[model samples]
Each structure stands twice: as structure tokens, then as C-alpha cells.
Target: MKKILLPTDFSENSWNAITYALQLFKNEECTFFLLNTFAPAVYQVEYLLVMPQPDETLNVYKESSLRNLEMLKERMQTEFSNPKHSIETISIFNTLVHQINEEIQDKSIDYIIMGTKGATGAREILFGSNTVFVLKKVKCPIIAVPETFTYESPHEILFPTDYGINYQDEHIQPLLNLTGNNVARINILHVDKGRGLTEYQERNKQQLESYFKHSAYLFHSVQNESVQEAIANFQLKVRVNLLVMLNNKHSFFENLFFKSTINQIGFHLNIPFFVIPTKLGKK
Candidate 1:
């Protein structure tokens, strides 16, 4: 069965992501693992040694996580009525990012679905944290659903890349799984800055071309505009249902997303975004 790991903090944004994941894979038999990580509210330090009574704090957190999971499950069953779907809940009293990485390996997670925002605005800004951290750190593919985005069929997918990183089989597979004989049109968009493609970049583009040669895909290029603006305009003109990007450091994907303000992110992305992390290049 397909195993999907969904990390939640019991926030409305997290629940929005959960509902989107359920509907996205409703027709397929899948097991959804609902995971939540909690840390102690207070830590005691003595002689430069910090101690946390994990057991004391975790019991209540576990209870609350379980209850919320049950509530989400019931709502799904009542709304979708899908018998093939199965769900499991896990609560960990540890750092969120650390626990997520550990569980991704331990549980053999397939994909991660999560909320773009966290518990509070301050926590989101100063730390430059939350789902963005998960996206950069996690070795698996992540589908970040905006809190306000409603579920929609992925009939048209907008993929923006700079042809910087070489495409890998692992990176492409998850996207293919989502598209799968659905008659979805994949728009492979490349934004040029007047420099044009170098010989090396052309070869990389060919590599992508060879992979999706048989798939219903098209290649397009737009020049003289910023990557973010191009993508936003493309979505508006084509009415894309999903946006896909390969997050390569210093690439347009990174600049347009990683450096932008959180509230402004939705301005560019009205649809759900699937982020595939590109392996860092050796210096």
C-alpha cells in the first residue's frame, strides 16, 4: 500500500493539508500516518546541564494528538466514505524537524504533506522555520498545501526550473506518480535571462526531455521576466491546478521562494506546490 506521512500540529492549516492529501489519493489504497512532535514547555538547567521531564509532559500531548487524529479520521470517513484508506497516529516529544527526519526513515514514508504555516507568525519569521525547513531538510518529496487552497484535480501542472541541476530518477518518480495516466498536461517552463542555455544546460534539458518523451508534456521558454512573475502569469493564463519546482540552492526556485515573504508566497502560488529538493552540488 502507498504510505503517506502527514505531519500535523493540530492547526487549521495542518488540517487543510490533511484533507487535500486524502482527496488527492482517495482512489488509491493508502495508509496515512498522522505525526505530531511536541517539546517540553519548560526545561531546568543546573551547572550548565539542561534537563527535561519528557514523560511528564508527553502524556497529555499524546492524549491530545490521539484525540485530534481520531477526530480527523472520523471527519474523513463521514465526508469521503473511503474504506480503502487507513490511518495511524504518532506523537513524539522531541524537536519537530529531528523527529520528522527520523520517522521518514523509520516508517519508510513515501511523500510528506504539510501546512505551509506553523503555530504562530513570530515562530515562523525569526527562525525562518516551519514547513520550509522540512522542505529543505527532508530527503523525500513534499507537497505543501496552502491553508486557504481548496482541493482541485491536477489537470494542469506548472513546472518551473532553471535547468541548473541534473534530473534524477528519484526526483521525477514522485511527480510521475501524481500525474499517472491522468491526461494531465505537464508544462515544462524555462525562464531565460538573455544568456540562453549553455552546452551543459542543453544536455541537462535533453535529459529531462528524454524522461518525459512519451508523457503528455510540452516545453516552453519565457524571457525578460522574473521567474516568479512568469510562473504567476502562466498559472493565471493556463489555469494550472498544481505548481512544481526543484529547489536548487541559488537557483531561481530558491530566490523566488526561499527568500520571499510568507504572506506574499500565496500571491504567487494559488495552487498546491510540490517541491523536489535538488542534491547540493559539490564545491
Candidate 2:
């Protein structure tokens, strides 16, 4: 069984993500951990100095968190009513990233499915700060569903890479599992920016081709265009429902996301982003 962690803040964006997850894995046996973390909005000097007993404010927040989690669980059962899926609720008073790290270790989480933006996220922003932090910090594979994105079978997946890192079975298992289950076609895209692929990159590309020989995959390349622009151009040609990328520090993925603001990068993702981290810790 797959262990998937879902973090919610009781927002429509979050609900949309949860709905997507349930539908994506409706036929499979899976356990979903519904997590919500809360902390005081502001810290008072007295509150910080003394570790007081459960205060009224803390109690109120904790109670609300638990109530919302239970309600969410009930809603999932009512809507899906799937015997293959089991729901677990977790309510805690801690930072979102911190608690997520703990849960990943404690539960051996396989994946995390969450919204790109939170309750207070702006319209133009592609990802909220929390989402960005998790993508950078968490090692688990994460599927960031767009706020208004409804459920769609990922018949075609677009994977953009520079062929920098050697592909690993463990790191790419999630992608393989998704495609194996959905019978989806994987489009491997590489953007050529004046210079050609190095010998190392060429070897990596050959290895990837071998890896996907049994699967339905196509290797695509475009010249004189930025990675972001190439992605946009390819999407225009192919109807891709899911976007996959490996978060390698030396790869263009890092330069595209970590160095600049998500929205300002000129690529606004309407489809779900399936990001697989190369390893745990900061990207």
C-alpha cells in the first residue's frame, strides 16, 4: 500500500487537491494522512518567555484544527466511499515544514499531494511560500495541484530535463509507477541553448532512452529557446496533463525555480507538477 501525506489548511485550494488525489488513486489501495499544523499568529513576550500550559488561544486553534480535520475526513468518505482507501487525521501545533519532516520519517511517506497555493495566496502567484519551502526542503515526491485544476487522467506526461544527473530507479520510481498505472505516455523534452549536450549529458540521455524502452516515451528537442519557453512551445503542440521534473541542484530546474520567483519565470503551470527530489534537505 502507498502512504501519501496530504497537508490542508481548510481552504478550497486544499480541498481541490484532496479531491484530485482521491480520484487519481481511486482503484488502488492507499492510506492518506490528512495533516494540519497550527501556530500562534503572533508571539507575545510573556508567551515566548514562559512555556505555559495549554492556553485559551492554543486550545481554540487546536480544537478548530481537529474539528476541521475530522470534517474533511468525513467529507472524503461521503464523497468517495472507497473501501480501498483509508483516511488518517493529524492535528498538531508546529510549523508546517517541521511537522512534515517528522511525519515523513515517522510514517515513511511515499508522496505528498497538496495545492500550489494556500488560502491567502495571490491570484498571479503560481506557488505559495509554503509550497515552495516544502518542494525545497522535503525529499518525498510532491504533486502540486493547481488551485482550479479539476481531476483529469494523466494520459500524457511532459518531463523536461537537461540530462545532467544519472537517472536512478529509486528517484524515478514514482514517475514509473504513475505511468505504469495510468498507461500514460512520457514526453522527455530537452532544450538546446546554443551549446549542444556534453558527452556526459549524451550518456545520460542514452541511459534514459534505455530506461523508457519498455514504456511509451518520446524524446523531443528544441533549439534556441529557453527551457521555460520550450516547455510552453511543447505544450502548445502536445496535450500534456502532468509535468514531471527532477530537482537536481546543478540542473536548470534549480536555476528556473529557486533563483527566481515562480510566476516571474514566464512559465505558469496550469497542469499538476510532479516534482521528485534527488535527495532530502534543501535543493
| Residue-level lDDT tens digits of model 2 in 1-283 | 9889999999999999999999888888999999998777685445544653546768888899999999999999999899999999999877788789889989888889999853344444557788989988888899999897888999999999999988888667888878777879999999887689999999999888888888999989899888888889898998899999999878888888887566665457888999998885331
Q: Give the Å error, residue 184, model 1.
A: 0.9
The runs of at least 3 residues in candidate 1 whose Cα sits more than 4 Å from the true structure, single-residue gaps closed, are 40-53, 118-128, 260-267, 280-283
Best by TM-score: 2
Deviation (Å) of 43 in candidate 1: 5.5
Clashing pairs in 2: none
Residues 1-283, model 1: lDDT tens digits? 7789888888888888989998899888899988887664463224113444455645887788678878877776787778789888887666677777777778777788987743344233312267767776777778888777889888899888788877888768788988883668899999988999998889989999887876789998999887767887787689898889887777776666567574455443557889876752111
Point out the worst 10-residue segment of candidate 1 by lDDT: 119-128
Candidate 1 Cα RMSD (Å): 4.2
Give the winner by lDDT. 2
Query: Model 2, stretches more than 4 Å misplaced?
Result: 43-56, 118-124, 260-263, 281-283
| Clash count (model 2, backbone only) | 0
